[model samples]
Each structure stands twice: as structure tokens, then as C-alpha cells.
Target: MNTPLLELQGLSVHYGSLRALGSIDLVVYPGELVTLLGSNGAGKSTTLRAISALVPAHGQILWRGGSLAGVPAHRLLKLGIGHCPEGRRVLSRQSVVENLMLGAYLRRDTAAIHTDLERCYGLFPRLAERRSQLAGALSGGEQQMLAIARALMGRPELLLLDEPDLGLAPKLVGEVMGALAQLHCEGLTLLLVEQNAEAVLEIADRGYVLEAGQLTLQGPAQELLANPSLRAAYLGG
Candidate 1:
């Protein structure tokens, strides 16, 4: 068997005195699309933050078997870990292309960066059309597209996405999810944190459910989708 691309062993996180993640264990193998599902305040976002080194954490986080302790948030990108955070954190004032350029700021290889930029444009033609417009001016769906594209500029081996479909209309949600499915089919490894169990289970190979800072359930997508408890809680009673 091959080594997992990422793993969290006994992962724990705290916000002052509050425990946000409690001894969590999870894994994502190379080229697989895995999802972490939970309701709001279930610590879904905190798990991603911890993995990205955005906040202080405890326990062992291994990327390709190397420790992530003491690794700062900014350096994770260079290590092939790219985070497309929740709430579409694209620079509100910057042009779409400018935002993408920021994603590639640390790279010395200009040619590859340019190539990746074109690839991003290819993945999202709307972005190409609004390439010169302020990112905030685009519609919500477009902003989400730009967010994904910017992260792609990093050319990551593992991409962590939080709430990719939050607050979008049903149609826009399908569009964003479709884009993610396309990327996953193209062999990108992803760890997706989402509340829409129905949407992610369709694309993810496996999933883990978190509840109030603890992992509650995990299994292959099909099993999770059909799980009575999961269906009742996330799908619709």
C-alpha cells in the first residue's frame, strides 16, 4: 500500500480555553477527493485552519509523512499545500488577475506561473472576461471561481477548500460543484469542508462527519450517503 498524502493523528486545537478540535484523526490519499462534513460550529473550518497552520494546534499533522508542527501559514503554499479558505477571501479591491498574481508571489519560476494562470483562465472563462475587473465587483459565483483559480496558481498537490458553495443559489452551487468535480477528475487531491452533504458526497470518494469538534462518522461516499444517521442529519429527515 502507498503512503497517504496527508494524515492527522490525534490532532487537537484550542481557542483560548475552548477545544475546537478534539484528538481528531483523518487521512487523504493522493489523487482522492475527500470531504469533511458538519454543521455550522462543528469545527469544520477550524480543522482546515489547523491543517493550513493558520492557528495554533496540537498533535501530529503529517504531509507525506513529514511533520507540520512549527510550520507557519505562509510557508504551507511552498510545501504544495494550498488553502482556498471559506467566505471567498479574494482581495476585494484587486483585479482578478492581480489576485492570481499574489497567489504565485513566492514562486521563482515565472514561466510555470504564467502557464498556470492560463490554465486558471481556461477552467473559468468568466474569470478571463472579468480579468481586469475588481474581484469584488463580480457576482458571488464569479468570486468563488476566482478564489479557486487563485489557489490553483500555487499548483498545489493538495488543495483544501472550505464551504465552496455557501450562500449561492442552487444553479450557482451546481456550477461551482461542477468545477470542483472537473478538477477532481483531472487528478487533483482535495480535502473539502462543506455543509452540503448531498453535493459533496456526489463528488467525494470518501467523507468524514464532524460534530462539535469530534469526528463522528467516516466511510466511503456511497456508504456515508446511505447512512441513516447521516441522511437524517444532513440530507433531510
Candidate 2:
């Protein structure tokens, strides 16, 4: 009933002749955890990219009813949007603390930034242990944690994650996914893109599926999980 936190109507993206996304309409209300599911090249990432103005896009991307046109990606943070891009693109050379500092590059509130930093440490205790280590030295799962924490440093209202579980071992995936679930429980709105449908659906409230740059199906997460076709195609029937 409250104003949706984010909305995309007729959203489309193209790379020259390649149409990465074609007229997708989606909505995320406050305090909901939503999953965007698809195979590679399905334009799931493109949707998040366009929302952040990381790519040239057409149609309307509204943030709390205001047009996001002309709003650059760097500025999205102040609007309570944070993106943890694909790949644990941590500043591998930097110390973990230094990397987190970069996430707040746009802010000048020293006190709040420090508070958030400790809060991140609380979320991922391992990060606190390796706070002085180089990001490159951490394991895959650790890197993923740092990536999410870095984005949290921006203090966003809704977090857009592009494959946070990608390439992690089963055990590591559980750790990272559990952390994400915890964040959602603490009132963080999330729009996630993941290939692990079963794991994601377990924690997500709703879901949307994309195929070849178009939204093919969407509904409650439990409904999608129980769907025969979805199970056969994505959940490995």
C-alpha cells in the first residue's frame, strides 16, 4: 500500500543490435525480498545496471515515484540504492578496511560511516578477523561478504546484488546466503539475480524469471518453486 520503493515500466536496454532487455515492468515494494532468476545473458544484470544508470537505457525507471533519468550511478547511493556488481570485484590490492572506506566515498558524515563499518563487521564476523588482510587474500566466500559489506557502507535502503552466490562452494554459498537472509530480516530490501533457484527461492518472497532479455514469468517465490515447468527448466527436475 505504501509507495513502491522502485518501479520499472517498459524498461529496455540494447547493445548496438543486441537487445539486452525488452520492455519489462516490475515493482518492489518496501521491505520485500525479491529475486530475479535467469540463465546467463538473460538480461537480469542489465536490469540492475540500467536502474543504476550504468548503461544507456530507455523507458521509465522510477525511484519512489521520481524519474531516475539523468541520475548517474554514483548518485544512486544517496537515494538509498546500492549495487554489488557481478564478481567479487573487491579492490584486491587494498586492505579490507580500506576497501570498505571506498564504499562511502561520496559521503562526508564521518560518525555514521564509522558506525556502519562496525555494523558490517557484526554481520560478517570473519571480516572483522581479516580486517587488515588484502582483499585478494580472502577466499571466494569471504570476498563475497566483503562485497556486500562494502555496498552496505553506502547505507542503502534497497540492495541490488548480481550473483552474490556465484562460484562459491556449497558450504561457502550457505554462509553467504545465510548472511543475505539475515540482512533481509533486518529490513533491507533486496533485488537479487541468482542461478541457484532452489536456494534463492527459499528466502525470497517473490520472483521473476527472464529469458533472452525478456521477463517470461513472475509470481510468489513459493509458487515458482512448485511450478513443474520452472522446476524442469531451472530447478533441475
Model 1 RMSD to the real structure? Answer: 1.0
Writing each residue's lDDT as its tens digit, candidate 1 over 1-237 gives: 489999999999999999989999999999999999999999999999999988888899999999988989988988899999998988999999999999888888988998999988888889999999999899998999999999998889999999999988999899889989999999999999999999999999999999999999999999999999999999996
Tell me the TM-score of model 2: 0.97
Could you tell me how far off, in angstroms, the CA of residue 40 lies in candidate 1 after the best superposition?
A: 0.5
The C-alpha TM-scores of every prediction are 0.97, 0.97
Off by over 4 Å in 2: none
Clashes of each: 0, 0
Worst 10 residues of 1 by lDDT: 1-10
Q: Looking at candidate 1, what is the lDDT of residue 102? A: 90
Candidate 1 global TM-score: 0.97
